[model samples]
Target: MASVSMKDVALAAGVSQPAVSYAYNRPSKLSQAQREHILEVAASLGYPGPNVLGRSLRSGKIGAIGLMMMDKLSLAFADPCTIALLRGISEVGELENVALTLFPLNNNRLVGRSPAANHGSLALRGLVDGLIISTLPDDHPAVLAVVKQNIPFVVIDSPLVDDSFFVGIDDRGAARTQMQHLLDLGHRKIGVIIDRLNPDGYRGPIDPQRFKSASERIVRERLTGYVEAASAAGLAFEDLSIIEAGGLDSTSGQAAAFTLLTSNDVTAVVACSDVMAIACMKTAHALNRNVPQTLSVIGFDDIPEAVQLGLTTIGQPMVEKGVYAARMLTEQLNAPAGTRLEPEQKIFATKLIVRTSTLKI
Candidate 1:
């Protein structure tokens, strides 16, 4: 059967096509009763409203934004921090009547395609009015590619590129504060568990050379913070035990925790994330080590689970980070043509939430 068009709806409703268009697009142009009558008539004629493709072509906008992340789609949803951030973005998108398109840059389904190769293609071909890039590494191929495209974008964290709005906390300072808490508690022996230095899928102790080659900016800064805090306490950097979890999930974190706790005679552990810290706590339990009495653990990103688990952590405004990034991008996209928005860096504060996981000895 032939599809019903606005003209057909207008003819059946005894109204002009432009009047039908106003009923859908500019409802204020028609009275409530008139608009309702037109809609009812159109509905009876099986008209499903406007052609989104045609409207997009006419307005140069698809009424959508892209949310680019470094992890696969499944991992992104599983992550508590990412979920909270998404909630904030969704709130804004709801108010603006915009749609969200997720681009998982690390999705393996691309069939033998390298991240750079896929990112290059995606940057050139992806269709969205603007982008919200979260936690991609500095010098990532996608970052440069997106910048080159002259697309309006907001960066959540990492790679503070030129002409891009940025939103994040002081990672190094937050990490330092986290470590300082342990140090102030007089814990000399410390073990550090990190998600990964890079995306190489290597799970083991991180050496100085490997640490230097870290591609992820946030991870590198957090490690630096731990090192700085230890150094300030007159501890040697070489003596600090650093283990890479190789992944952000619980399994990798548990494996890294087991390795660190079993090999090192550490009195405390500092994890790069709450996930890792919770893993450390579990490992400590399995090893018959009591938290704060025999072992102390500190974590970053005070996720919801952290409270229930009593994990001491650095609390960042996760949802606020998302809300700020989305708002900034939307503002730029909604601006008048040729209006230049000065890209601003929004750095939120971090707090130390000392829970039952740490003890001074």
Candidate 2:
């Protein structure tokens, strides 16, 4: 039996080889009827279409982008904030009619545990045209792998390493504003619930050096902003009373709230995210503490639930961030190498959404 080829398909379909290739690789180049006819003929002839690897090599485009996340795919899907960003990315993808491939990092390894550990292998595998990585640490091993591969990539809510493209809010400034809202309300005893600083996922006292080393860009920036705001208002860092949450969710927020609210000296709680802040509210209610009167609370990221709960927070454009990231990656994939996009660091502004969650003391 003779093997089927593009030439064979073209000859049978009554079209040129280039036309057959166009029907498979560049579908838009052919009329809809022509493309359908070619596909139908190829399918009847048992041709499986063109080789993707060969097409990629010839066109220098994969028509797809990689979206990398730190946590499991299930967790990423569960988070509303992450979902919004993903929706934004999907919108752009829909417009371009390209697919987004999810590359999961094997969590079984000890030394190479994180998604960063396997980034090099994934990037070198030539599965994606570019990468859009969402993680805490900008210098994570997986991120470095993307860099080593020299693949066009973008970072979202991570540190700026080597002037790569990024889409995020002003972490330090937003944190400062959020904390200052509590300060202005005369809530002196403020407590903070922060996500883990290190990739090892330790939940305890944050050592300065280790925090510096393991901290993602957003975490460090927001912490700095909170610290700065506290200092400016004459509140000592020691008095800030920080609790490190194992993860960024309601459960961790509630646990942190339980610990902080139990203290008679604590009057206000500042959560890093709306999910945590709302969790703190639920915990406070369980503890019989009246919100805004006995304990004022503030959260960041004005997710949908935040507004309903009247939770005061800093509103970062989550959807826009995702959209911008997708746009940036697409642009990088389309652009020539060595040419940087305009405004490499796309920083979105945040606003303080004052609601019923906080009150003047």
**What does candidate 1 score on TM?**
0.81
TM-scores for candidates 1 onward, in order: 0.81, 0.78
Those runs of model 1 whose alpha carbons end farther than 4 Å from true positions after fitting are: 1-58, 93-96, 108-120
In model 1, which range of ten residues has the least summed lDDT?
107-116
Candidate 1, residues 279-354, lDDT tens digits: the string is 8898889999999799999999999999998889999999989987877776566443566766778899999999
lDDT of 2 by residue, 1-361 (tens): 8768777888999987767766754456689999999999999999876543343455776666787776656767777788888888877633246667765442333116454555446544777877787764555666767777678888888757676888878889999998999999998888887776655666655545655675656667787888899999998777787777767667777877787777547889888888888988999999999998888989988999999999999999999888888766655554333445443777899999999989998
Best-performing candidate as measured by TM-score: 1
lDDT of 1 at 95: 28
- What would you estimate as the lDDT of candidate 1? 0.83
Candidate 2, pairs of clashing residues: 116-142
Q: Identify the leading candidate in terms of lDDT.
A: 1
Error of 2 at 325 (Å): 1.1
